[model samples]
Target: MKTNLYSSIIEKISSDKFSSIFILVDENTEQFCLKLFIKKTGIKSFNKIIIDSGEENKNIDTCVSIWDQLNSFKADRKSLLINLGGGVLTDIGGFAASTYLRGIKFINIPTTLLGMVDAAHGGKTGIDFKLLKNQIGVFNDPLEVLLDNDYLKTLSKEEFINGYAEVVKHSLLTDKPDLTFNSLVKLDLFNDSEYIINSYSLVKNEIVKSDKYESSIRKVLNLGHTIGHAVESYSHISDEIIDLKHGQAIVIGIINELYISHKKFNFPLRDVVSVKKHLKKYFTLIPLKENDMENIYDLMVYDKKNEGSKINFVLLKEIGKPVIDQIVDKELFKESFVFYNE
Candidate 1:
């Protein structure tokens, strides 16, 4: 476990001084990463709540189920809930804990790379609605986060690669950008637990600077997600499954929208091509059908960031300099997909 995770969690717990501790885990976390908790902390007597895992299980019903479980445990504001799993567990569990008794202290012990780097750091909590991703959620920070790279050993290649996308994106947008998309796409570091954990923590600390609230600087984190989430939602409905991992979907989204940046914002085309080459090595270019584009485009309109019909995308003027609020043209949006498929 990284020192930052323990320190962050302890700082919050000490500040809050909750009366009871409630830890949340799904079936998978219990199997893979439970012992880490036992070794690190003296918290042997915490209330445990288990829920189903996976994207499909992320819903209001799941939140309700957690709420009911919290009630059963007689959880109060003085109690702290520690979400100990992947994004699904944290998102849904955080929401349950937050809503219960009008918000309680919650900590995130993210086991998956996805959770540690991206999902765990952010205070955003919610579940999907109507097959839409994170359609219902709130922006609230956890008391602290616990990140252990050892947990990633159980991840499949696809899952590891999926989580790697965010790391690549973070690198691309940051000053050092030391971790190239090529190295990550290779997925060779799957065995290097320390490297995996440190990489995620570096990115987390970068994006989660003083702007932990996500009002200004943090919106840059949505660089790929604005379009990726929409594409992922459409893929979920397709019969073929689209074979798109979360990272793969974001890679495509970034590429397609990078094209938008190139044309609209005059972003460098060479940088985009370099990134595409690196990403395409790991992610097969999925051909979006005409209807797939339409459905995904429609979904983008419903994005929470939108103030009106215009979709605001965080586009890069260059590789590291990202600018937001540039409303993407729908016709041009369609054309970018064409370029992507080509």
Candidate 2:
């Protein structure tokens, strides 16, 4: 366990006399990071609740199971929950804790890059509804956050790269002007502990500063998620499925929207080429079928961020500039996919 993560949680939990400690884990995280969590947090004899880990299991049933566990344990308002796992566990657990007993103090111990940089930091907690992503959730801040780089070793290669997408997005939006594509690509991102921790802190601080409630500046965080989630949902339902991690799907969304941005904003060609070149190497372009396109467009319309009939997208003005709420023409959204146009 890293000292920073241990100290961070202690700072919050030590301030109160709690009923008991409760920690949440999914199947994978329990196998990978449980020992370290116990060693560091030292919450011996804490109640442990485990769920099946995947996008498919993030639903009402899982939430109900968690609520039942808390009820059986006699968990009270002062009881603290340490969410120990990836984004799915953190989101579901946070949602359960918030609704349980009208919310309780919880700390996040994220074990994946996707969880650490994005899900673990922000207070956004929820599960998907009828294949839509994060449909029901609460805006509750965690009492503390713990990011230990050691957990990265447990993530699969795809999962590791899945998270890199957000880090890349952060650099594109917030970093110094000198932040270039090549420099980010060449970054020893996973190997160095300091780099990973710094990146987590950087994204966390940026979101916390801008839209702690996810109403304004935090909308930038959804740059690729709007379409990305639609893509994930499409894959989950369709017959000719395309399996895509959230980051990979978001990368595709970035590509499709890049075309839109190029047309609407006259975004620089060189920057577009740079982004495509870096991401294309990792994620192959998946063809979207006609039915897939229609379903995706429908899902995108229901996005929580949409204000009216027009769907709002966050697009780039340049490499380091992000512009939001650029109303996307519905037709363009459909035609942008090669399979749909064909």
Candidate 3:
């Protein structure tokens, strides 16, 4: 919950005593975030490591490269790593830092809206394994998270929309009437950044505090992620990579899961339709062929939320009211795709 920006972060880091300081960025952040970071802070005394920017790069090979760089730089147990990028950078950088020499102190400077609202705040540090999403990771908190809206100024509309999906997901999880479907559809991120970020963070942090290990209440945060991750992984491993972003996949997942909610939990059909209609305005519907469903289902079975053969879902009983650990049959899962297509 402790967030600062720009010079304040530089001052904080400058005052801290550590064996060494390292800044982890992707190719994009190196140009967009790190350069501005150095200029604004007037501090240039850190080792710089850059990786490729994409979900495909979120893997063990990236971790190995990072660990090698840290070792080459003689980063000891007391080294401090500053992750300055979007979700991929924070996730992989945190994972590398956590596992390197047991553990090291780190800070998150999330450049993307999604990173600011969700990925950077959560203590879930991870990387994908074997084309699965977040298949390998550990729970490790950062020294601090520095969120600056300035970083979002340079984002492409696609990137902005990608992050906005999490905002919508968070809004749906809250009872606040101000975050209604109409309000969400009309949201202007530049004007509403402060309210959106703080509100979503508050909800997420409270849920995480109650269940740090994702044993119960925390599962609510995974509302769109179960099917979302499956779709994401499918896009990644498909014969032709479907150019789908994480949030886009999640929006699709939310709509499909909303259908399940309508059928299984008697959630209002009208509400489900309303949510889907609003989301479609911002996200393109990715074509998922019939053959793709089985592959997506196979990926879902490997989800960390599942146990044995049953795939556990966090379905909505109503907007802002989620019922967790609900198991749906495979037949229903296939049918949900049909519902999505219709």
The best candidate by TM-score is: 3
User: Cα deviation in Å at residue 179, candidate 1?
Assistant: 5.8
Each model's C-alpha lDDT?
A: 0.78, 0.77, 0.85
TM-score of each: 0.89, 0.92, 0.94
In candidate 1, where is summed lDDT lowest over 10 consecutive residues?
177-186
Q: How accurate is candidate 2 locally (lDDT)?
A: 0.77
Reference-based lDDT, residue 17, model 3: 77
Off by over 4 Å in 2: 10-16, 178-182, 338-342
> Residues 85-166, candidate 2, lDDT per residue (tens digit)?
9888889989999999899888888888878877887788999998788999998888777777788887888888788777
Give lDDT tens digits, candidate 1, residues 96-215.
Answer: 877888899888888877787788876889999986788888778887776677677776767766776787777666655455444444555456546755775676577768577677
Candidate 1 similarity to native, TM-score? 0.89
Error of 1 at 234 (Å): 0.8
Pairs in steric clash, model 3: none
Clashes of each: 0, 0, 0
Using lDDT as the measure, what is the rank order of every candidate, best first? 3, 1, 2
Q: Which has the greatest lDDT? A: 3
Error of 3 at 330 (Å): 1.8
- Scored against the true structure, residue 111 in model 3 reaches a CA lDDT of 92
Task: Output the TM-score of candidate 2.
Answer: 0.92
